[model samples]
Target: MIRRQREIDTPHISWPDKLAYSLPALSLAIIGIPVYVFLPKFYTDTIGLSMSTIGILLMAVRLFDAVTDPVIGYLSDRSAGRFGRRKPYIASGSVGLAISIIFLFKPPVLSGAMINIYFGFWLFALFFFWTLVAIPYESLGPEMTGDYHERTALFSMRDGFLIIGTLLAAGFPMLIDGIMNIMGKVATQRELFSFMAFIFAPLIVIFSFYCIYRIKEKYQQTGSDDLVKGFSAVLKNRPFLILISGYTISAVGSNLPATLILYYVEYVLKAQRAEGFLLIYFLTGIVFLPLWIVVSRKVGKKRAWIISMLINTGAFSGVFFLGPGDAMIYGVLVFFSGIGFGAGLALPSSIQADVIDYDQVLTGQRREGRYIGLWSIAKKLSAALGVGIGLVLLAKAGYQPNAEQPGSAVFMLRVLYALVPCICNILSIVIISFYPISEQAHAQIQREIGRL
Candidate 1:
């Protein structure tokens, strides 16, 4: 019976399936730029909104995000159709995300309270649909294959594509430059984002359909499908909470450097070389992803993640000393940071998959959506909080866009950009150390769940 159950839990996933599954993540990575890195800068530098106002607006957006993820997750878990439980959300949400990007990138001209209102409204719409598409899509990963290491292989492909997409997004300005040159004109940030939206619209549609048509959810939710029970089970699951907390804090650490990289390059380093630096950073991640996957396979995800955090903490600690005209030095540090970046990207979700399996063992139901949704909430909050903290801190330090900031401001930027993330990384290592779900432990949980 145990052997049969083990056989039932594990499914073979072909390479074609892995490639197809990875395509949607490319779209996700492209769209992520405006949300994670560019939007704050664009709104502040171009639209003339104060940094604090933008920070508050972002916090508000993420606060709204906090509410929607679990609600969507719950609905997704309860949802069923000819396509599958997860695919319907993926399709509809992708469409919604595409439309929202269009409006977000090209809002009608407004000023004063109206600009903030406009930004907040579209950001809310953008985040809502993003949650819709992302949560269900993430939930599908663990269900694709139950093999412990194979999950890392799948995400390696996913994040590899994600890095490629980010690189493309970064190059949009240059892409705009080439196109405008061909047409005998100039380029702008708004135009770059507009072009990106146009490109991503079709890509999102194509990939969403491809995944819906190709990838099928392998595990069916068994026993009671009660929503209340599902929520209770997830809430009561200690390991799941530990994993989310660790991932969330690590996300905050990850986001700070991202949120500040553009500023770091422009003001602190005083160079028009931010995009080049970002390319190196993401490209390094692409190169190191397979290595991190191998490390995870060898040492297990939790330990591998701790090692990644240590490496990143060391890298960020080095950044505390860099000043103007230190772009090359920063580039070397970013390369090491990207190694940690690669591990953080691939391992956490795979670890979450394992944690979800433990939840199955405890609750006798498959609740990947709820768990992923909650994880999404934490992820979003971390990004929002990172922005809020950075902007608020900088505002207090008298940060002004496109102008020479005071010495105190420069010090604040450098500290927030480097030190805060180091602290967060240290905290993440501590939190992750408590993660009890080892590969052997997950295998035992799978065995127990399979027996039921």
Candidate 2:
């Protein structure tokens, strides 16, 4: 019988290793923005579907995601490919994602029953491909480095570039319009999607392939194990369970403000150019992202996370008190909120990677796939829940898309935008406080595992 090798006190990863290993994560982050930020709006506005209908469709598709993520994770964990367990899936998933993204954006001219068919097929393909890409890519973080601080640094770089992708995704439509104006052509939403799909599809394929080529995995298994047992062992890991639970709830908090931003800008503030305001909101967070990394390094990840959450809570709370003409005040608040948003966006994965290390120390097996799978599941579930909440509240408030809004609807929008996220964010801080792994504790665990 071949026993798993005990950990050796390996030297810290050199800068070259960090850069090489981080590429896959950076690629995923860039590709992920389109799915998270634009897809909902695409279905509702561009595809001419009702918000509630799109919400239900997304919810059903995510139910399927809940099933697939863990299974994929388990399979990847137990895989013993010649290239490595993750590389095969990573490469295949990237290709699938590129194809699906093109299909998603460029719908054929179909009417009546064919329209429904198009929607269903496209939705299925999108979620299927996303799971394939996201689960394996997230698994790489924990597998790349066992050090706690180093994980934070790795995730910081990944998320920093993620913000770049988000900014491009957010800003691309406007940027394309400017270019089209110069070329004496009009740019519609369809035209914008076409342009982005054409540009980004090849980039996703190439960057993902580059990442697969550049990164190397150290973990390898030659023996097979029961999939059921592998999953059960993962479930029994307490630290991972706690972290996932907290993160799922925290995801709701993170998504609420973003989901409500357009409504707040258009209905409450009466801004015709609401996307510009949204861009400002996103850019504010991007600018503050590096500062959060520095602070996390100085004060430690958990405390830094808590501080960021409080700042966000305070900023979100300010919206509740705003009157109709408070756009400037709201803008200022959004800037402050981004300070907290940057922390929330960047730190959780690093913390999750730490928990994975704890599990490896206890079980003598590297189960990054299982942990990443659960993490993906938690994030998707929370996003689904957040969208569900947004739809429910919109319905309750009698919000009709593209209709002249009523005072009551606008009032309710403000309250939901401010009160719900503030309360949820405060709760998230409390939950994160209960997370037991300090940076110091994680470093000591790495040392202990090295001596094992």
Candidate 3:
């Protein structure tokens, strides 16, 4: 029987390796903004679908996509060939992703009702291919290194580029608009979106291909081949249960602030530069990310993550009281909140690798894909809940678009954007405090697995 590659004393992953592995995130993120932020408006305003119809379609497709995560994860875990389990899925999926992205962005001329059918079909395709690439891609991370602290650096690099890609994605529409202005022509929403999809289409494939070319998977197929049994194995992972519970709840809270930031800034703060403030928050996160890796090494991933959550929670707490003429203060708070942002993403992922190790000791198998699948489900579900729950409440509280919101609506916005997320983080901290693994525990886990 083949044994897994030695991860305990592995050398530091070179920068080149990290960069190559991280390239897909950059491409995926660039396209993600267009899909996430621009797609609904494009269909509603450009394609002539009503907001209600688009919302329903989006939610349905997303739910379907979430449900598919486990199946793909199980399939990826079961795949065995010379190309390896994750790469084949990623490589093949990027092709489908690229094609669907093109068609989705550049919808064909069609009859009125057919347009909606066309939209839903392509949206479903896009998400399916996205899951195919994303689940396997993320699954590879935990297996990349066994060194506890090094895992932080690894995921930090990945998430650092994720932040950078988000910033670039947010700015690209303006970049296109700027160039159009120089040409004495303004780009329409459709044109702007078409350019984005076109540029990122080949880019997604190129990045995935590059990653496949450079990085190698260290495969050990000791896991169960049966899907139901495989998932049953996952359900019993206590560390993962606690970690996912905490992360999902925190994500629900975190996502609330993200979905409502525009509403809060426009209605409650009555301030401008919402985009500028967002840029500051993400830029600060990317710039200070490496510092968190160091902090994780010094203090340990668990403690580092808790500290990051605390910083973010404290910074957001003051937002509920802010109103007009408080953009500067809000900016300061956003910046402080961002200081922990990279750590918030990177450290948990590193700690998640530890949890997977804990799982391996219990089941005597490596099932990164299933773990990541569950993580993805939590993330996507939380995102849907975050946006949907807050909007429903805001509507009930008397929110009206493009008008002065009522006092009750403003209060609800504050609670969702500020107080709710802070409470979630505090609860997350408490939950994560119960996680039993550490560097020493992980090392012992490796030893135990080796003996098996």
Highest TM-score model number: 3
lDDT for 385 (candidate 3):
89
Candidate 3 lDDT score relative to the true structure:
0.87
lDDT ranking, best first: 3, 1, 2
lDDT of 2 by residue, 137-249 (tens): 77866777676666677777677667676666667777888999999999877777788778887776787677678767767662355777777877887767766776677
For TM-score, candidate 2 versus 3, the one ahead is 3
* Alpha-carbon RMSD, each predicted model: 3.6, 3.0, 1.4
Best by lDDT: 3
Q: Give lDDT per model, in order.
A: 0.82, 0.74, 0.87
Q: Candidate 2 — which pairs collide?
A: none
Residue-level lDDT for 428 in candidate 3:
97
Worst 10 residues of 1 by lDDT: 1-10
lDDT of 1 by residue, 61-109 (tens): 7778778888888877766545567888899988988888888777777
